[model samples]
Target chain A: MSLPTLLEVVNLKKTFVRRSGSFLKPKKTDVYAVNNVSFSIEKGEILGIIGESGCGKTTTVRMIMRLMNESNGKILFNGQNLCGLSDEKTTKVRKDMQMIFQDPYDTLNPGMRIVDILMEPLHAHKPNMTKEEKYQKVKETTEAIELIPAEDFLNRFPHQLSGGQRQRIAIARAVILEPSFIAADEPTSMLDVSVRAGILNLLLDLREKMGLTMLFITHDLSTASYMCDRIAVMYQGSIVEIGETQKIIDFPTHPYTKALVSVVKDLNSFIENRETMILDGEVDSTKKTLGCAFVSRCPHQEAVCHNVVPSLEQIDKVQSVACHCFGSSKMGISERSGALV
Target chain B: MGKTVLSVENLSTFYKTDKGISRAVENVSFTVEEGEILGLIGESGCGKSTVAQSILRLIEYPGKVVKGKVFLHEKELISASEADLYDIRWSEISVIPQSAMNALNPVHRIGEQIMEAILIHEHVSKKEALDRTKVLLELVGIDRERWKSYPHEFSGGMKQRVAIAMALACYPKMIISDESTTGLDVLTQSQVIALLKDLQRKMNLSIILISHDLPMVTSISDKIAIMYAGKLVEWASTDDILHDARHPYSRALLDATPDLINRDKKIVSIPGTVPNLVNIKSCCRFHTRCPFAFERCKVEEPELKEVKPGHFAACFLEEENHELTYTS
Candidate 1:
């Protein structure tokens, strides 16, 4: 908890304006892809940005990686504004901040061999290095990712590898530069259970061995609980809840977070005891609403919820929730109490 | 006793690729009784989908069902000709495809698609078909007003509901839901699961639910069948499979799954990858990755045998002691 901050995202926002109506006189409506999101990651800490699709988790990571420019706010890496840096300077800083995408097949080039793919980062960052140095780095990294007898896979293309091995190569490519921070957006969602398990263990091992900080983004709460030190539950381009992983799982505060947690299928729970907490509707990410975004689907919604935006309030030392009815009588839990249902 | 709605025995399917024949589904078998939900579980590329496709004779050119007997009630599906199979499909055994969002025709109205499906299978009038389409939409919990809406106009969950409605248009005795909730969000996935459960109860429909998610499958499935590398590794009740899985692959998959409640248990991902399917020589396919694999696993493939009264597993260790030891 006392670790120093490695990356700080301050109110990062990205808006996409689409032109509609007639061509002569078009009307532009702004889609708030990512709006007013703020969080900080400490060194060696795995902070999960958990949310369903189109909740701006991807946009948030994209802006931090500087793949897409933000419309507003700042991303501070070591107390420096990353958004305003020059092209050359940003390219230099990119080595310290790398990203691992969700689909390993799409991220990797099928035409290139595994060796060349892993060596591209080295050649780009340290172009003056000898061929022996680049080859040595690739060999070490390939072995580190458990592609043992690195010679077996060095000359092979991605199509020749399995899903698990392809993902391992992706991890090797991401960490070959030894970035200080990594933004892994659903790195294992496309993988199988056993493969995901291996990748999760490898990431934990890499964090310990390399002292790496991470922002692991996923929609699965169980994965977040297993891998993250702290999780930030996002809804409609905003984080509705943020806390320690276990605390959020055990004592979920926000209504949306409660719905999400309840919906997660517990392996040990019997079917008869399986709680059915259904939300009324899907996420409306394109809407420019004046009130809380989850109001339409929240079971505890009231008149005030439809008119006012709720800011995050600290409930405890490590837990924070952005809900107006967190500790109030407005909750619609008729029979059971609102505490950790 | 409930009647056997669908029974598959000794089913083997192969895909002829340029390199070699890929053993996609080899000697897999299971049964779905009337009003029962059987979950076919496995990781991606483990041939769970192929099993479903093979049962319906839906495999394409390269993929052929070399040997098997797929019985829907008393009728044999594997031996049925194209014309006979056409008459049986959608009327007797329907399928809810994995990607519901892409299943529906983007240009056609939801009602039209459902009506088309009904008209093709049954001899119903246009007015009756339209009325039945409305009923189908209502049965899946989708509003009847949205029947005229195009697939793109509806939400992802709504599209999935439409797919379910299409599957239920002819009231098939058994429905093969191929990863029906795969691409949906958590809340939507739960909603879809709930809707499927509700439909099953109201209509007494038999379902063969296929998914890679163990926990999600356990939620609604009465029986669970685990597949690995195109073979059936374990088959038992949901409780038994979740609590006392005998096969090393099933146990490893269970251990690899991160539980929402049990946060303290360490997840143990099985090392090594699935064996190559091209001309796969197996005593046990999972022998390379299995921690408890011994000398016998290399020489002979273990057949799935009864470990308990109703539970079955294909493991030599289970045959000996009925338990797997977890040691590094």
Candidate 2:
């Protein structure tokens, strides 16, 4: 429906070699950060990936960017398999796809001034461009991120800037290449709460102004709901739910989604009266799964849920949920436990 | 509520700088009922930590609680001696700092460190302390065997749970978790919040949760208070504060937050940063940043007055009109 589906990821997988706690040395057991994950983004659409930490969200983005090789799968960017591309081709492809990391403190170079740091990406991508051209591009990008007056901040190092200003430099760097797609990984998590909204608004404004298709990664559902058009809720390495923002927020079908929605303390009196569904324990990233990854914490989880991994099925016009009991009302409100609803 | 466990009245703390003294807290008052969780929501440098540190007299030199009172039950803490404060710091009121890993001693075994606190406060034998420590570890969902492990052996979430367990060891009536789960991942934060709620119910304890995270705090706390530049701008029940916040600062803060459940029509950030708190004048702390700042705000600091049944707001608009016009 949109601009010929610019990027498509078909069944991507990645594994990290983690060391187990023993004298046997670091064994090669896969972390399974991403497994058989498939999704596509239109030319100028912002596709959001929502997940807890260790949920393959980062790995998936890294794989698409070709920062790390996918264990197996096809990533077609502009009808070219990113996995099949030669080192030279990949380098060229990397020019158009860039990532903005979560920690601006760690991402931005402490030694370099703001101008030089933003200029790094341009120097690398467009080596043919003159120094003046690159410097002008850096100025424009800085101005776009509202690091204006960019002239005043051009010579300041990362340490000299505030948390919000440092992040703006990082964003400027990522966008200086004028990448078609961006993977911003929790960009505002490290910034102060007062300054976080400024960065987010910048991203949204830049998306329209610069024609960017961003895959925003964050754990805060509030931010995701506000920023994203279509939300993909990922648990462990799988997309458990995918739908339009309003439907998923108002009438979530998956138990995990419901639990997450229930706990989203509302600013309305109605939320005060609504019961909360408190999920116990942590999201188990270490579990080897043949069935549902959310079964451990899902209150409505049945024997069948433990036996098979449910696929995403259309619940309505705009929402699709991956859960064994999504079709029924049995798992709605009756299955919750002790709470001040 | 079982009983009133912690009562703070007109607590004023000032940070003395080379320039001059900046009043960080002014006549802030709040009470935490037993088995209650009072969430203090604010941006950074809002003087929330100062309030927490003042309760334990943890505020160091150059920073002092100039006036006002703090009471743990009936014990007056404003003028308490250093030795008395030390005795009550952990035994009566303990704090879980922002960084769980940094709060703990890195060199010692975690179990041994916790046992030290138990031994110091309870006057128990080493063996009894060890046993009590194990019980506490199990209570916090950590295996008792983890007692032998070092701090580095555990993950960030595990370290947080251990820190919480150590705080529970002395049976403190009030626990102040200063951004306790801020550094952790969202999943870990939720689990920790659930565990905190469980422990509060079981122990019938009072908690003062200080965090920059507004939405998360609203879900967990019994009531909410918004602080700005060392002043309590608003304080109300979690329901009323979130639903009908009267203070302009509170409204802007709520607008600033990215709603997890429902996104706002437009992303509206609170314009500008908090004023630098050094040699400040008699004007309202939020006047520099407030969208509705008028002549009255710049000249006179608005007093926090009762707006609704339990809602308290500090703004000249509310003071003059007796109601607030908050645009969603």
lDDT of each: 0.88, 0.81
Q: What's the lDDT of the predicted structure labeled candidate 1?
A: 0.88
DockQ in order? 0.62, 0.44
| lDDT (tens digit, per residue) of candidate 1 on B38-141 | 99999888999999999999999999999989999898999999999998999988999999888998999999999999999899999999999999898887
List of chain B TM-scores, one per candidate: 0.98, 0.96
lDDT of the structure predicted as candidate 2: 0.81
Candidate 2 residue-wise lDDT, B74-95, digit = tens: 8889898878887888889999
lDDT of 1 by residue, A220-339 (tens): 999999999999999999999999988888778787777777767443232223343334575666677788998878767778888999998888899888988877764534422434
What's the true lDDT of residue B36 in model 1?
A: 95
Candidate 2 stretches with Cα past 4 Å from truth are: A1-3, A20-26, A126-139, A147-150, A265-287, A300-341, B1-4, B14-27, B104-115, B123-158, B299-310, B320-328
In candidate 1 the C-alpha lDDT for residue A257 amounts to 79
Write down the TM-score of every candidate.
0.95, 0.86
Q: Where is the poorest 10-residue window by lDDT in model 2 chain A? A: A267-276
